[model samples]
Target: MRRRTYLAGGASVLAGIAVSGLVSRPPSNERLLEAAREPSGTGEGSSNTETILSGTDHETSLYELDAPNDGPTAMVFGGVHGDERNGIEAAREISDWHPDAGTLVVVPETNRVAVENDDRRGVDGNLNRQFPADRGPQSELAAGIWDAVESYQPDVVLDLHRSLGIYGLHQEFVGQAIFHSPDAHGERLADRLNEDAVPWYLPFHRFTPGESTLSGPLLFQHAARELGASAYIFETTEFLLDHSTMVEMSRLAAAHVLELHGLLELGGDA
Candidate 1:
């Protein structure tokens, strides 16, 4: 059954809805400059060559690092929202990085327009919202990328994003970090995953999926599986950060993910 909901003002929200407009933070011009240069490709070893998703503005692109492996693949998609810096950063690290002997697909920014124009969605549309089947302007941009994802058939899909500065009611922001929404599955520790030093919720309750949001990891989690893929979301601390720090956190998560897949050089990379 399909349900439609609006973006909630507070943290606590229910699931199953079509959220319109941008979620929370939109990208600023300064943020867009982080990767002003044209995206290039790199696939050393058994990996395949990298490529960029070119927009009207060539510089505003999604650089994908495709490593060759026929086994169950892992897709690391970052920067679907221009304002969300952590995923993009992680994508960059993985591109240059060679993890294990398997296929790894890294898309630094699914929404290139958001990154380039420093906007949530691109000039034409919001890539994440547009995914799964976006024909473009007349329809949705979501199709292009999500289609790739479906065809890739990644066993796991890790999407990087931020927790919309929600606190108390929905989440809590501690200094640089912000806790994210729990999965529909009731995995408590899963909420605080990949963190260097953090504890699971002191109290647990029935998970309340955030604002039946438009499109994102939430949508992917439910939608992707139907296409032969599992999905996960990695939330970064709310707010903008220095490019370097963003890159580092992404690397940490990527390392953890690789380790989880047992592709980090056979054993013990985490």
Candidate 2:
């Protein structure tokens, strides 16, 4: 389903106050949306693309969207597992969007080899599991991705994926869920999606927010632990929903996170 667009007003007075260093408070969703819709006075919201792991088998494009205003930075990833095409598509779409405030860094196909082969992992094993908590990334590909993360120093990190079944229904699968770090706003994102994007007839498909397992060597977990960034892993189920719905769900999750971090506006339409 196509998302509904919201017509926003002028930039909020709250944003002006915050910019002037007169008050410190979280901007309301409406205010953020308004601010994001406003034109950046500076011609700085330009986008650039670069190659990650250049001249290597795992090479992929990395897109960076810099807004005219200075704000928090967000890094988004997809294609960690090749079979998860929804996330890959959503990330690719997001790569072309323009952020209104902070920078947006996107790696649409993190594991290019796996994506090409339609497999879960590349020859070096699961790319998602290569980032151990105590040490540097174990594989060359993982290390290159990690290097980008370190260089950007993003305030938020979002990893998108797909699962074969619902998170609670399937013992090993974690879909229709947002696994988040302690500092992340997973619950809020879940609530927003459930209220707007989810269909009433499919109550079972509603998004859930859960605390991420720190025991695993997941990229989101590693970023949260090491950089203290708000990190999340958004998963959509493939059991009942069609491919398009899954892509929409992943897109909504990423857009909402960007909105929550004041990087974008009207996430429902983003």
Candidate 3:
């Protein structure tokens, strides 16, 4: 498969700014705790369930953890690129998790074929590029993932991945950062994640539609615009954080987002 060129220019500028640290410095531990201290939400509480979503040639698992309180639904997926080990680990961990409130849907592996093969592109093509299908038919795997996303009608969606290089440091990489759609909800969450402690923290980076046009149809953007769900793409740097650290950071990021959305109670106060 050929590399996409749409994001070439915009990514350069974003990287430059991020490397310069002009945006904001990493927050201190106390500051992080203070900034993180927001009112938590309450939940009705329920058990966890797992469902296997199957398509023509691919099958992935979906875990649903329902809270006693009827709240928003959150969808988190990983392994769309197969080789992104960090996201896959995080997604799998989230699958077994029980949220404090609201509904949590975890798709640990979006591209089962690609993941099994440890390849970026599946047998059909890049699963990430096949989303929100415009003209041609969607790959079987992409279609299956889309069906699950649509059926759940999530209030927010988080797509996790691991980038090859660190953002700002590597011109071609978008790692160690949060790539968000135009939706304000997702953007706000990205901002919050930006303030996290070092190593696990990520800077907020917004890619304009024109910049990402050739990157393929983005499911996150589609979910935000079409389904009215706050969506984001969380990319961790494989260079800076080890696989385990990356997974831990991904979990922290997801928990923060859930808290911000009031989907889960942050502390016992709620």
Q: Which model scores highest in lDDT?
A: 2
lDDT (tens digit, per residue) of candidate 3 on 1-270? 123332454356444433432223233323323323322244234545554554455776778877666678999988888899878987887776656557889888788888999998889887776666345337666666777888899998888887766666567887766766554355555455454524222333321111122234777766765677877788876553446656655766776666777765533321
Q: For model 2, which pairs clash?
A: none
TM-score winner, 2 or 3: 2
Stretches off by above 4 angstroms in model 2 are 1-44, 266-270
In terms of lDDT, model 2 sits at 0.80
Cα displacement (angstroms), candidate 1, residue 108, comes to 0.6
Judging by TM-score against the true structure, name the best candidate. 2
| By lDDT: ranked, best first | 2, 3, 1
lDDT of 2 by residue, 142-238 (tens): 9999999999998999999998766775567788899999878988999987865666555766889998766579999988988889999998876
Please list the residue runs of candidate 3 whose C-alpha ends up more than 4 Å from where it truly belongs after superposition.
Answer: 1-44, 48-56, 133-137, 185-191, 199-216, 267-270
Rank by TM-score (best first): 2, 3, 1
lDDT agreement with native, every candidate: 0.46, 0.80, 0.64
What pairs collide in candidate 3? 43-69, 44-68, 44-69, 45-67, 45-68
TM-score of each: 0.58, 0.83, 0.73
